[model samples]
Target chain A: MRYPVAPPTLADVAERAGVSRQTVSNAINNPDLLRADTLARVQEAIEELGYSPNRAARNLRTRSSHLIGLKFQPAQEGTANAAMDRFVHSLVETAGGAGYHILLFAVGEDEDHLRGYDDLLRATAVDAFIVTDTYLGNPQAAWLRQRRAPFVSFGRPWDDDAADHPWVDVDGAAGVDLATTHLLDRGHQRIAWIGWHKDSRIGEDRRSGWTRAMHGRNLSTTGLASRTEDTVSSGHDAAAVLLDEAQPSAFVCASDTLAMGVLHTLRDRGLTPGHDVSVIGFDDSQVAQVINPGLTSVRQPLEEVAVEIVRALEGLLSTPAVVSPGVLLTPTLAVRETG
Target chain B: MRYPVAPPTLADVAERAGVSRQTVSNAINNPDLLRADTLARVQEAIEELGYSPNRAARNLRTRSSHLIGLKFQPAQEGTANAAMDRFVHSLVETAGGAGYHILLFAVGEDEDHLRGYDDLLRATAVDAFIVTDTYLGNPQAAWLRQRRAPFVSFGRPWDDDAADHPWVDVDGAAGVDLATTHLLDRGHQRIAWIGWHKDSRIGEDRRSGWTRAMHGRNLSTTGLASRTEDTVSSGHDAAAVLLDEAQPSAFVCASDTLAMGVLHTLRDRGLTPGHDVSVIGFDDSQVAQVINPGLTSVRQPLEEVAVEIVRALEGLLSTPAVVSPGVLLTPTLAVRETG
Candidate 1:
C-alpha cells in the first residue's frame, strides 16, 4: 500500500507566502521576532502547506537530541528468555541516568545463523548503540568500526579482528570452572555437562572450562554425557538419554533454563536434586529464584554488565581506542539447595 | 566529560581544508563531480578533521530515515517480565519486514512521566513510534498528538482523550469472561480471581468481567475471593491465603506467571491442579508449557499484535486520523491439562 509523502518544505511554504526563506525560518523557529500580523500570515501559510521544520536544523541549534540506539538480534522464533528482559531494563535505566533515551533495532539471523549487521548500518537515528549476543567474526563490530559509531557489545567478540571495539561480557569460562570445580570438590565423580548452541562463543567457552576442570582431575569428556542445545525441552531429552546410559552425581548446565528441564526429568524418575542428584546452572535468572528448593546457579552480574557497557560507550566516545578491545567481567556461583 | 566530538558537517571540513563549502559537500556526497586532485585534497582534509556526513541533513534529502522508535515505561528495578521481551522481538521482526528499524526509548515513572517525551520529540531520526504499557491519563499520548508523530500502542489507552490514537491490545475483559465462564460450566461453585496491580486498566477490566459473569449467576463479589498483584510470589502468597480461608474449586489467574506460582503453592499443600482444583491463566506464555500438567491459559496473539501495530503505524502515516483512534485485537484461549 502507498503511504502519504511528507508535507512540503519550508522553501515551498516561503515561496507560497511571498517571503524570503530566512523570514519563514524565523517565523517557525523564532516566532517572537516577527510582528503579530506577520506571524499570523506565516502560520496560516504553513498550516495550508503542512510545512514541518527540518529536524536537523533544529537539532544543530539545540545540541540535545536525547536519543540513544540499542541494537539487538531477535531471539529465534518461539524462544523466549527472561534474562533478555532484564538486560533491556538495565540498558534503559543506564541510558536514562545520562538523560539519554534508547531505540531498539532487531537484526535478522543470516543463513549461517549470524546476525545481520548491514541493517544496523542503514539506520542512523540512534546516537550510540548497545549490542548483544556476539558471534565469531561478527560483522556488526567491523561495521561499527568503519562507521566510527559509538557502540558497546554485551558479550566479548570472538575474534582478534575486533581489536578496536569495546565490550562488556560475563566470564562464562570462569563460571563453568566454578561449577565444575564445586562438584569435584564435593567428592562427586562422573559429572555430565549440558550446554547451549555450540556456535555461541559463550557456550564454547563454558564447555571448554568444564572440559578443562574435568580433565584436570582425570575425568572423561566423551560418550553420552555431552549434549549441545539450549532449549529446555532439548535438555529434558538429553537428560533422559544421559541418565539411562550412566548416571552422574551432578549435572552442570549452561543456563538456568536447561537446569529446569533436567530438574523436571529427574522428578519424573523419582529423583530429588541436591540429594539423589546435584544440579548447577548459570545465569541466575528469575526461574532460579521461583523454582522449588531454589536453583544453585552461577549469577552473572547483568546489572554490572549493563553499567559497564554504558561506561565503555562513554570511554569510546572520549578516547576512541585503536588497540586491542574487549572486556570480560567475572561471574559468581550462587550455592542454593539444589547443589 | 569533555569527550572529543567528531565533526560531522561538510562545512567544518571545508573550513579546515580552506575550500568552498560546496566543494567539500560535493567531495563527500558526489565525489565524481570534483576533479581527482580536489577530491583527494578534500578527502585528506575530511580524514584530518574526522568529518562524516551529518545524518540529519541526509535524512532531510531522503525524506525517509530507516528508523522507527519503540517506547516503553521503565519497569521498577528487579521487576521485569518475559512477555515484554517477546513483545520486543515481535516489534523488531514486524518492523524489519517493512525495511524500517526500531529504536527503544523508555520513560521513567516519575510524577510527570511525560517529561521524558521531550527527548523523543527532539530526536528527528525515527520515522514512526510504537508505544506500549499505557496507563490512565497517559501524557505521552498527548505529547505525541501535539507533535504529530506517527505511533501505535500495544495496549488501549484508558482515557477517551486517546480515542484517536492507534493501538493493538489483548482483549483482557473477553479473556477473563472466557475463563470464568469455563469454570462455571465445569460445575465450579467456588471460583476465585487473581490479578495484577489494582490501578491498571487492564486488571480492572478483567476483574470487572469476572464480577459481571459471577454476578449474573447470583454469586457474591466480595465474599467469593480475589487478589490483586502481578508477581509470581504474590500469586503464591494469595493462593495460601485463599486456601486457608476457603478452598476454591478453581482459580483464574491474571497471567501464566501467577499460575506457575499458584501451582507451586498447591503442590506444597499436597494438592494437585486439574485433579484437586482446576486452574486457568492468562498469556499462554512459554512458562505455561514447561510447568507440570501444562497450564491452560488465554493465548494473546503476540505475533498478530506486532503485525497489527506495524500496520497501524503505516496507516497513521498515510491518513492522519483525528477521530476514532485505534483498534483492539481479541484474545484466544489455549486449553491444556490444568483446566
Candidate 2:
C-alpha cells in the first residue's frame, strides 16, 4: 500500500506559508497563538498541500491516544436485539465531537473476559475503555477498577455497591414501568410479563415494573409471568403457555425478540394483535418499528445516554480527573399500533 | 479517571521476578531470548502483578498504531439493512487474530465526506483504512488514492475503470440471480423486481441479475420492474402499483427493507406471501430471519469478505507491501418461507 510520493509534512506547509515549522504547528494546534493573517496563510498552505501532523510523534509528546477501547461482542444468535448497534452509532457520533475515536476489539466467548482489556492496557492502545457488559456477574468493571484503569461503564455496577467508577445507564425498571402503565391505561387487566432468567439483574429490574404496575392496580400477578432464556423460540413457547394457562389479555416482554415471539403466536392462533390482544416490547428495536402493524415498545434514550457518557468521559479525562457521580437516564415509550 | 493507586509496571514485575528489567522486556517482546525456566518465572511475576508493557512507548518505537480506521455512517433511516453491524462484527473478530483493532469515526451527512479520513491520516491514528462506501461516484476511494494512503475497499471501484486497489465485494448480481432462479423453479414466470434509484451502481447490479435470469429463461422483462428509493414505504408503494397493473406472480427486492414493504402490502391486502405470491429480499437481514413466515433472501459472504480483507491488509502492510488483486465472493440464497 506504500506510495512512491511522501505525504506533505509540517516543513512543506512552513515553506509554502513563509513561516517557521513551530509557527505552522501553532497554526494547526493553537491558532489563537498566531496572528489572524499568519494563521490564515498557514491554513491556506495546509489546505493546498493537504498536510497532516504526525499522530505518532504527538502520542510520544502527550502520552495520550485520544482513542477509547470498546470490546464488541456480536448479538446472540436467534435474538431480535439490535440495541447495541444503535448505542454504538450514538457513541461514535457523540465521541467524534470530542476528538475521540472508538477502538473496537473482538473477544470470543471462550476467551478470558478481560483479555481484550488486558492487551489494550498493556499496549496503551487507548486512553481509556467504555465497558458495556456490566451485567450482574460480568467481571470487566471490577477488573478494570482493580487495574486502576481510567474508564466508564455503560451499565451500573449491578452487584457492586462499593464500585464508585463513573457510569451512565438507562433506567430499565422505569422504562418497563412506563410500558406496563401504557398497557394498563389501554384497559388490559390481565398483563403477562416475559423476562430473562433469574441470573440477569437487568431482566429482574425490568420484570419489577410489571409486578409493581399490576400490584399498584390491585391486580393478581400469579401465573402471569415467565422467566426463560432470551430467544424468539423461548418467547414463543413461553407466550404460548401463558396464553393458554394464564389467559392474559396482554403481554409485556423483556425485549423486542420476546415480543416478536408473542406476535408470532398471535398470528398462528389467527388472533389479531392490538385488536385481540395487545403486546409491548422493550428496546424499540428495528423489528418493533418495522414489524407488521408495528409494535409498541420502550425506547431507551440511547442518544442522550451517549451524550452523558461522553460528558462523564470528559470529566474523567480533565486535568483534575474529577470522578463524576453515576447517571441513570429514563427511557420513553414508543407507542405504536400494538399497544 | 485518575486512581489513588499506581498501575503495576515492568520494573515491579522485574523486581518481583528477581530479574533485570531487560530480561522482563525480552520475555514480553521475544520470549525465546530467555531461558525456559526464567521465561516462566517472568510470566508468573507479570501475571501476578498484572503488568502490561506501555503501548505508547512501543508505538513511538514502532511507528504503527496497529489500528484500521473505518468511516461509519448510520444506515439510512427506515431501511432494513443491518448488514453493516454484521460486517463490523466479522471484521473485528477476523482482524483480532492479526493484532489489529478497528477504529471507528462517525461522519455526519453534512460534514465533508473525507474530513474523518483527513483527521485520522494527519494524526497517523491508524496504520491503514478499510473503506466500505464504494458505491459508484463516492469520493472516499479517489481521495484516499490521491493522498497516497493505504486502504482496502469493501466494494469494487464501480465508477473507475482504471483504478487498482485491493477490494473484497460480494457479488450482488449472482445473489439476485440465484433468488430469481429459485422463484423460477417454483413455477413463477412473472417475477417483478423492486430496486433502488438508477444512480446506485449496486442496486443496478442487483437489478441486472433478475433481468438476466428472466431473459435466460425466455421470460419477458417488460412492465415487471420498478425503481424507487431503498425504503419500506417505497417498496410497499411500488409493490402495490406493480401488483395491480402488472399482476406478477412474485417479487424480487433489492433490500430486506423493500421486501418488508412488499410483505406489509401483502398483509394489508390479506394475500398470503408464499402461497399467493412469492417474495425474496437481499441482505437476508435480521428482519428476514425473524419476521413471520420468514422472508427468503440473499445472504452475503460477509465473514469471508472480512477474512479476504484481512489477507489483503496483511499483504499491504508487509515489509515490501504487495498490492493484492481485488476479490469478489459469490453470495447464496437463504431459502425460507417467503419463496
Q: Which candidate's DockQ is highest? A: 2
**Interface RMSD (Å), each candidate?**
6.1, 2.6
Tens digit of per-residue lDDT, candidate 1, span A98-189: 65666666655454322334334333345566777577866766666565666778877777552556778888888998998998999988
Best by TM-score: 2
The true-versus-predicted C-alpha distance at residue B137 of model 2, in Å, is 1.6
- Residue-wise lDDT of candidate 1 within B1-339, one digit each (tens)? 233334345677787788899999788779899999888999998776556565555666665565677765432322223566667778777887876767666655563655445444444556666777578766777666556666777888787652566788887888888888888888987888888777778788877768877887888756555565677678888888887776788888887777777887888988878989888888776556555567788877788888888877766655443232466667787888888
**Residue B284 alpha-carbon offset, candidate 1, angstroms:** 2.4
Error of 1 at A199 (Å): 4.4
Candidate 2 local lDDT, residue A270: 92
lDDT of 1 at B30: 90
Residue lDDT tens for model 2, A1-339: 454223567898999999999999899789999999999999999988777777777776776788888988665545678888888889999999998999999988798878888888866677888999888788888788787778899999999998878899998988888998888988889999999999999999999988888899999999999999888888899999999999998999999999999999999999899999999999887778777899999999989988988888887777768788999999999998888
Give the poorly placed runs of model 2, Cα more than 4 Å off: A1-49, B1-48
At residue B330, what lDDT does model 1 achieve? 74
